[model samples]
Target: MKKLIHTLLAGSLLTTCLATTSAVNAMTVSPQNWWAGMQNSSLQIMLHETEIAKQQWYLESYPGVELKSITKTDNANYAFINLEISPNAKPGKLLFKNRAGDQFEYPLLTRDKQSAERQGFDSGDTIYLINPDRFANGDSSNDTVQGMAEAASPSERGGRHGGDIQGIINALPYLDELGVTQLWLTPPLENNMASYSYHGYAITDFYNIDPRMGSNELYHELSAKAKQHGIGLVMDLVLNHFGSEHEWMKDKPTTDWINFNGDFADGKHATSHARQTIQDPHASEFDKRQFSDGWFVSTMPDLNQRQPLLATYLIQNAIWWIEYADLSGIRVDTYSYSDKAFLADWTKAIMVEYPNFNIVGEEWTSNPAIASYWQAGKINNDGYTSSLPSVMDFSLQESLIQALNEDESWNTGWVKVYESLANDFLYPNPDNLLVFADNHDMSRVYTELKQDLAKTKMAMTMLLTTRGIAQMYYGTEVLLDNTGSNDHGDIRIDFPGGFAGQKTNAFTGQGLNSDQVDMQQTITTLLNFRKNSPAIAKGKLTHFSPKQGVYSYARISEQQTVLVFLNKNTTAKTWSLDYMREVLGNHKSATALFNKQKVKLTKPLTLPAMSALVLVIE
Candidate 1:
């Protein structure tokens, strides 16, 4: 392995010989490595080094790969090499020699056997959201890396904690037993910021994993191990912006690499929050430009996706992860904040390669019409065609919270949820939406329901059985709350007993109180039952309007019908069977899975106060 980097002064090709032999030092090649036998033979290899453009290089042909073209960017340090890898190509190295006698090699490994056939997470999967920095601590040694800016400070809300990839890998069995089929971890990629980098949003390196979290090899290990436990890993990434410490910041590939507040020289950008401008009909060009081009914060520099090379780089980065880590899905942060055209193209490119893969965009809008515009087959009036398979159901999430908290009235309590679902027509494929009661960014579901266990259970039941992909934050099952404040650090609390010598361990159930244990068991039972329920997985849902303080819905499939009822009354309410006769049809009796009791459809069933009932009918 050559570690020494040799470079010549500012000069054209053959100005000087820096090294007599090939060297693999001082160069960043992304994707750092690639696989042979890909569906698309074309590969774009991006390279950045000290005055690398001035160097001369030629491809030493190998069995599977062929050199196509080397396009130098505006920046002298950057170069884009295009290659054609034929299907007949096998795993090997494609050697190259520069004019100055320095040699470099690109490894072409065999693709995973299931690369193209890999299935992404979908509506049938239950996603367990983990904020790794706050989730658990498996390896204490990686708590602080030497070169990293932020070190481990588990006690602080926004400070880095020791929770790494191993932490997540250690809790696989716990998650599996909880019945979560998919794992959605917030970005584990490197942030390398000065502070407050625990959230992993301000990424400094796209090709490498956060050393504090783990290594690139370990990320692969986690994904592989997760598959064994029947869990699919969904990688969360930010394409819109990157941390100021990113390598490209100091030496951008082009003049327009990033939007510097429409002024690149001095760098003092103005507008930061402009997410709504993309969909606003009255939005001006200036506002739209600012929204897509403005930085998220002074620490995060907004990338210019309009730059063709930059756009391609972002697209390839996502594809590289799916191929390298065997990821089942992608959760793009601030989806609509990026260039709209670039988003459409970016989603289309990935879907084309992995036709079965799922990518859920985070369009955090409460309006159904705006949220629907990003989903596939939306047929927007703007004539935009988005290939995204799913979107985070922000509209439904908000409605569910409001529905459970307000008093019963027109568009108030249960009607809020009913009305939210009624807007399903606006969405192209409502069933594919990603639904959840709360996430790392918001108040915990327990806190949102004001610590009311019954209301919490009702919200959980509604989300779990609804017609969309269901997701739950890590500490939700144990009643994690951020009651007094909305600080994210409070919302994304560290798991009890995640560290050594801790007293309360949610995993082993060693020190949890009765209420915590019960909530955990409740979630486990509901998720386990939902895992095999065809009626809840892919069934057609029909919900009746909330009436007399009672809300009911039925998930109907060819073989079974799953019925759910929620009573908002403070007092136990007896519901008549006559009202639901149309949905009941010929089923004489239904088994209540919650208590394992059978209820006769011919007779009225009394529901406990503020209760949720789940019944399976054949």
Candidate 2:
């Protein structure tokens, strides 16, 4: 009887072992081949398990690889292992050994050296900014989350329209023909909010990309594909705050992890505080603290960048993405809201790690002095050194608005842009300024200008031909507009025909109004022209306000010289040659870029009203 009972138990144990082996074999790993987006000699490997605690798993690289550290995360199901690859470690499969002697193999690909350096894109490139959820709905299956609140349909202005990273990737050829060289999608990081999370500003997880948009792996793939088409990717980073539902809020890491935790503080207004503190002779420490540390919104918890650990975490998160995505640059959102010291340190560290990388900060100050102060080489009266290389030219935006809305008189209106350009001396490197007519935060450029096509064209003409770097918000080329509503939802409208069921498609130039098509063609022509024109890329800028409502500038290099003239008058105005004779000395003949007409200038040239002219002088 004892022998028979022992045989039965042994048979049951063998059956259980075989079942486990079969289950392991049935499991599948996606994205069979893995390529590190950005990497160096040192690598951090994160492993996740559905059943067993990751701490029970032992991770070891190839025979010649060196282990730096093996760390268990707060969640026992994940493990973080740091390893140093051998200088000649042949790229192969990474083996993870579990306590049960079960092994999982993941293939690894070595870094592409040429591609890594290509990550840093140039200013000559046009950036298309899309609010993903409002751009297109390539995949509708992932529209609603299981337990999350359901968003309204695409027709609803504020609804989550199911636009994903795949949609943008699908429409790459459209962007490419539009002469876009870089794509800046608003923060794709996870935002687990119940409503209005479509904007992606309130991030819940820094490490994971929003599943609604796509997986983190898909994002890396998008970057790789973008690079293949001569396009770069610029990540939008938010360091000031995190979503209130962020995991850290549930269980505080430290008492000082966030400012005014649980309890909300009425955030101080930005303009006065940011501008006054920098300009004030006796700015209070308390006031400055409130300006930078206050929460942006009740739903967004402000991060205490002053905290050492929190600061380090934020910095490392940014570096991890830069190295992980092989990104071209970063456009920091709400840049002024973060601690000034921390911002300086963060930028400095990033610049040190990637010497040639560039970062543009969103310091939305309309004053040139205030904007210039944040740039790296600004000579401030107060000894403030910023590691920031570029700042959004809010002054230029103000100038554009004034030029469009105001009268054409010399002392009053449309010449504000010319006058603003004269103030470029205030900035140490004016060429580095990111000049834009509009962005995601504000009303669409078309809406702001009251849907005036001529003014829109003028804005694009200046943006493309100007001295500084230029950025065009998505949909601007197609003249996308949100007529009455000034809210963000309306501003970030759905791109026409982006969805599968849509009757009109912007990609094929179908279902577009005549004005929209004209704007698209104009922008495309100018951008492609600028791409091959060395005269516009690296040229010396010279300007003269020959008269009211008439402004002209020349960008000259050793190989080529190009001149631009803006005439805002109702009638054709003749610009006297005497006023610009010194600058145009020995240049008698010029060819217009748009019309391809050549003219000999002896006395004065007639510039039409509400028109811009670009001349190539040989």
Candidate 3:
């Protein structure tokens, strides 16, 4: 009898252990739980669980959590659960359960609680744009995937370099010290393309973060850390197209889901003829249709934003990221490629949702008139309206390139840039323009200037002290080079010290040339100076002509005033203050922001050749 009791006791213990193990195993996380990264009210959670087929899956939360509905798939293994969370729902863990008593937990991050009315960004901040894969490889283990055809190699221009979000997060201190207030990363979404995915313009899954860069959760962590350092996050959004290998492309929901369903063609040239039509006085319908409905590349299938369902999905996806990652702004890629009406609607809805947030569109035109038409507040005679708050200052880019490359001719001297600014009257809000010399699509500014250290410094001085918002491409300050080619791959070189085995470290300022060091120091000095100056942010700008290849401007406000002089001549020139008197406002003593030297501006200010200066009046 005692032996029998011992057997029964041992059996009971074994049973309990098996039950606990099974319960723990049942609580598994979905590998493709993309919705888990979201942080908004309307959330659609897609689940794949074969074991829970017979059981009902429901979301449970504390009071104020509103469950929309539970939808089960025909396969009985998938669930599409929708939930509308209350604004007051506590930011914490959300538990999901099944009828069999299995449970899993996911986090609900803090939503942006600020109202939509607060919409204005100060000009003192500098935006740093980075191409993730080439920036730094914080995690190299995920560089090459099993199915991906491209191999990981730094020497190969088109191969993946494995830069991840963690690399940038780790370099926050370096960026902060460099006077960067905003970080704009290229789209980190999944790109399952076969080759040349380093640029990240073609997205395969809008909701899933690329595993090569780390999981979606890592991106959220990066945003949180960035906010702690007072750095705003600017997500690069691509609403125009998706990779050809996208899962949805295999079985499109509708025939009109893509621009040329099943039939592919190259995109039309982005010329005035293509864009100005649709309402042109004499435009062929064929031209207009081709302009609006053409593929960007054979690999990038153009999305049909004109379709209401697709439009809503794209808009909602953008909002989800903003609320999820607490993004400060969005840099919409290929903004002109999408449907015009749909683009207008997308911008309007986003503004309605977060009026305070900023959206900068890339129009990519060298004409100020063409670029200004896309910015908000432009009164077009054609009765068209755009909700975009800001646009890339491509006109300024052209002027800067010209000013650096051309000689001091009477018609095209350093005054090219000065003249470009003079045309700011065409823009509804010139200060809202995103000014940059080079970006991901363009050659490196240093390479374009032929590695002229002085010219690069002058460009930086003007970009930081100018009247518009400044965006500096990553590695610009360090004189990062892409010398021989203008291809996208060449432009995005890997950041130093981002990977584990790198010998040189950019973060700690090691292995840098003297010119690079000087450039880095110059940018840091100028940006830090602008950071505390309210005059540069909201002051009125006034400019004067090129005398002896010199151009000058002054920003004045009630509390503070600043003057900037650009001298491009071979010899030093004395810039007359007579024309800038209107904005200088009777200031006699001027202080140099970079060198901290005091000067009496009662006489003409002497500016060195190929140099720029920022003078603050006390």
| TM-score leader | 1
Q: Between prediction 2 and prediction 3, which has the larger lDDT?
A: 3
RMSD of each: 4.0, 7.1, 7.5
* Candidate with best lDDT: 1
Total clashes in model 1, counting residue pairs 3 or more apart in sequence or in different chains: 2
TM-score of each: 0.95, 0.83, 0.84
lDDT of candidate 2 over 1-618, digit per residue (tens)? 001011112101101111252242221222222434333455555444442344354556475466677655444443455666656666676675656556556556666565445435455667778888878766677777565454536767677888998888888878888888888889988888877888988898787777778777778888888878778889999999889878667755556778765456454432234545755679887777667767767888888898765676677677767766779899999888888889989898777667778889998888887788888888778887998988889888888877876776756565688778888898888888888999888998888888988778877888888887779988888888988888888888888878767676778988888998888888988888778777677787888763677667888877778888877677888777677676677888898877789977676788877788888886
Model 1 ranges with Cα > 4 A deviation: 1-25, 261-272
Tens digits of lDDT, candidate 3, 492-568: 87777776776766788888878878888888888787787777777777777776677677787777888888777
Q: Number of clashes in model 3?
A: 1
Predict model 3's lDDT versus the native.
0.75
Order candidates by lDDT, high to low: 1, 3, 2
Q: Pick out the ten consecutive residues of candidate 1 with the lowest summed lDDT.
A: 8-17
